[model samples]
Target: MKKIDRNNLKTFKDFLIVEGEKVNIVFSTAKYDRSFNRNNDEGLKNIESLKVDFNVNEVVYLHQIHSDNVFVFNNNAKEFIEREGDAIVTNKENVIIGAFTADCVPVVLVDEVEGVIAAIHSGWKGTFNSITKKSIEKMIQEYGTRIENIKVYIGPHIRQCCYEVSEELKERFLDKTKIDENELFNGRNLSMERCILEDLRSLKIEEDNIYTINLCTYCEEEIKLFSYRKSVGTYGRLFTFAYKK
Candidate 1:
């Protein structure tokens, strides 16, 4: 776990977490707009405030096709790439990687020894495709990072109690992977949190090293966490970002 720094936030927020020499976690607790929720300046400002003092290389994001395609940012090619994908890993200390979500989980990874970090978007579709495992695999292959030294954070999002899905979605999970029948749909597995935990345990991410926010975006209006389902389609996005200082 990282120490709490009350001075870094730009507003009244208890959503961000800073850890040791290698990692920081930012959890956004609100939706900034109503029309398709396109306005996210507030969240961006809050995210940027945490970046102060970091070398800050190119930040990474994806169109988030909700697949298992994980990219490694070893070279400068992605600097100009505009396409969206599910995951991104970087070896550069200054590079910050982030992913946006209103309800999806922001799965952050850091290679403590190598200073490599990844910000991942794990919607239900991505989890079915094994996005988490793939990101860990990409880091090891591209940066020689060890899964043991990597610090993992599963930030706030929709939790399982509120994540119940329809019969169609439940069936979809059964058809996709080896995941247990209990994890899926409208109020099922809760997408990001449970799936990330499953991946960590499966990949040996260790229960001790994994940290979670355990927040259900849909349940809390007081904290301001975004909830697409709660907002009934019109919801603004919140960002999850990390950079080296």
Candidate 2:
């Protein structure tokens, strides 16, 4: 098992990869000199460059629809399908699974004991629908992954400090989870982390095994992380990926 050096980790341009017991995780930021948006040709080039850096044969990108749908990577398939889903899980090595997000939560789950990994995109809608929980259930059913042995990482996103929501949205999240109104909505904004953490704990994931970057994409101006809320309609996306190797 490779121990992760969280304090001494390095970044390649705006990309950062962290090693774990059985999986390698990578995250891309908007801080690079060039554009790292996954919506254009330049973004494709940057993604290819990351593939080399991570030493993965291919990177599977999802057609995210903010739905609870989870795609299970089938390496035995003849063709690579870009399916519409919010999360992906697989046991295949050397194939990086990834998702794009501007304000949504990018979650990576690794069952080191079972050698299974997952990449999830959890926006407000997806989180409300319990997408992360669904993905873990899928892994457990398909890969025999034990919930307690799974290590989870919740990447940067729009935190409650900057994620103001409408009354209807707040009520919907409240109805979906056990989080209190005060913690769920801080007078002006909704707490996405609180809701997500609650959902993970409900599924029996140990509190200590779950880690969060705790950085707000909308609050950190110096980091250059993409934020749809802050940029309005002119923002790019940050990529989060994971693979077992």
Give the per-residue lDDT of model 1 (tens digit) for 17-115: 554565655555454432122135654455455445344545556666777778776656455235668788876666667777877777888777887
| lDDT (10s digit) by residue, model 2, range 107-208 | 998998888899999998898888899999999999999988988888889998989888888777777786778878888698777877888878889877
Give lDDT per model, in order: 0.67, 0.81
Tell me the TM-score of each prediction against the true structure: 0.79, 0.92
TM-score, predicted candidate 1 vs. hidden true structure: 0.79
